[model samples]
Target: MVVRVFHTATALANTLAADVARALRSNPRLVLGLPAGRTPIPLYDELARLHRAGRADFRRARAFNLDEFVGVTAKHAGSYRAFMRRHFFDRINVPKARVDAPRGGARDVERECARYERAIARAGGIDLQILGLGLNGHVGFNEPASALIARTHRARLSLKTRRANAPLFGDRVSAVPREAISVGMATILEARRVVLIATGESKAAAVHQLVEGPVTTRLPASLLQLHPRAEIWIDRDAASRLRGARAAALRRLRRSRRGRSRGRRAAARARGSR
Candidate 1:
């Protein structure tokens, strides 16, 4: 596990975009697993900028979203599919047919999950999976008690997830669906690479636990620790709770960057003075 701490979300976003661009260049057919939430908004915008500038190409890439709320119409603003379209697909050049997500609002949720899993398999599996961590350490919609489901399937939402996602559905917890379809732990762990994005002090404790704690069912996101290639990118606020030595080292790295920026400015001023 590699932890990179940035001073601000904007810097983190830029860094993530650059890494994504590098991934695309290395593998044009990269199957990207996308996440939806406030955490990745800036990163999506930055990727769109790269696409517009012709620095990145997503036309041949395929995308699969992590999860979607059951019973929510895809046209609804609260739907994860809508969220992905609004933040990413609509802005980038990914082919519409190649981008797939589980069908929400289906009469048979189980069948939909099965079909979605099969589609991913037919497309050659995901190459890189991007994720957003919930404050309670849930990833996708795999809540705390769902350690048993080893394959892709539908899930009943936990109370904590409903509460956390309430704002997305007109700020009413009652309006948030009680269930969702998510790509399972096995699917995410199967990816060639995994990138988890988190921000804000509200996520600090959870981030610390997920990054260093034991891989347990209680902290579902902690399962990433078992992945062979997983990277976590977080801002300083979200990394505040890491242990002493690690936190101190991160601070020193930030300070070093600041010092270099200050030296550059000082040199520019000295030239002007001459």
Candidate 2:
């Protein structure tokens, strides 16, 4: 796991957009796993800008959302599908046929989950996954105590999760669905690369737990520590609790800069002596 702290949300979003653009440039058909939430909105905006400038192409890219609230149709104002379309899909060149989300209102949710999992497998897995840190360290809908290696399934939303999302439903906790269909932890860990973005002081504690806490089911995001290609990008406010980690990263950066400077100086001296 690599942790990068940025001074502002825009900086974090810009860096994330650059990485996504590079991936798409390298593989136009990349299968991307996307998350829905405030943290990723800025990144999506940046990606849209890149697409408009012809710097990034998404015509061949495929996307799958991480989760959707059960009982909500795609047309629902607060549905994750609606959120994605409004913030990203409608703005990019990606074909609508290539975008998919779990069927939140499916009568046979078990079958739907299986089908969605198969769809991802058939698409050759995700090349890159974008994630946001939940206040309680949940990823997708895999709340605390969720099975560490579970696959796609229906999840009963925790009260904290519902409360956190209440504002999206007009501040009515009752308006938020109690269940959701989510890609599980095992599915997310299978992605070729995972990028998690977090901002604001509300995320500080969860960010700390993810970066420095032990790998425990109580903090689901902590399980990313087991992934080989996971990167965490967070704003300064989100990383405020990681004092030691920040200092260490600064020291390593300084050393790298010093090494480069010394190499240049040595090369110049040798040229003059010659």
Candidate 3:
């Protein structure tokens, strides 16, 4: 795992969007796992801009949302499906039918989870999975636990998440769904690559925990330690706690590399002049 810390959320979003755009170029039929929340809004907006500029091609791309609230119509204003449509799929060229998300308000949730998993399998699994970490280090609603589940399924929301998400539901905690269906940790880890974006000081503790702490299900995002190709992009505020002598030393090493590269370029220019 690697961390790319930016000074602002917008910069982080642009960087992440550029990475996704590059991935699309390599594989036009890329399957992306998307998350819906305030964190990823700027990223989606930047991606939309790239698509409009003809720098991104999503015509053959497919998307699957990370999770959705139960007990709500897909058309509901606060639904994840509505959030995805408004923030991403609506602005991009991804076909409406190819953008898959679990059906909410389904009387048979077991069938919903099964069918969602099967759909993902049929699509050849996701090429890149984007994620947002919960305050408790949860990833895609797989909250703190002693063990991680390995498939798509429904989960009860933790109190902290419910409280934090209340404002999205008109500041009515009761209106927030206690349950949501999420792609499991195993499913997320199966992606060819994964990108986790986080911003704000409110996310500092979680970021520090997942980056430098133990790989325990108690902090679900820590499972990334086991992933071969997962990267995290964070803003300065979110990385506040990670600042230290060791980080400063690493920064010095990076600057040294840049200085050497610049020196080599100067020598090459001098030779050309001669």
Question: Which of candidates 2 and 3 reaches a greater lDDT?
Answer: 2
Q: Rank the candidates by lDDT, best first.
A: 2, 1, 3
Q: Which parts of model 2 have CA positions greater than 4 angstroms off? A: 248-274
Give the alpha carbon lDDT tens digit for every residue of 144-211 in model 3. 87787788898888999888788779999988999998899999999989999889999999998988
Candidate 2 lDDT by residue in tens digits, 14-124 = 988998899888999999999998889999999999999999999999999999999898988999999999999999999999999998989898899999999999999
Model 2 Cα shift for residue 177 (angstroms): 0.4
- Stretch of 10 with least lDDT, candidate 1: 145-154
lDDT of 1 by residue, 1-274 (tens): 8888888889999899988999899999989999998999999999999999998899889999999988987888999999899999999889999899888888998999999889888888889899999988989988888354766788888888898888888889999999899999888999888999899999999998997788898888888999989998898889889977768967897798899999999999999999
In model 1, the runs with Cα more than 4 Å from the true position are 261-274
TM-score, structure 3 vs. true = 0.89
- As a TM-score, model 1 comes out at 0.94
How big is the positional error of residue 77 in model 2, measured in Å on the Cα after superposition?
0.9
Quote the lDDT for 261 in model 1: 98
What's model 2's lDDT at 99?
100
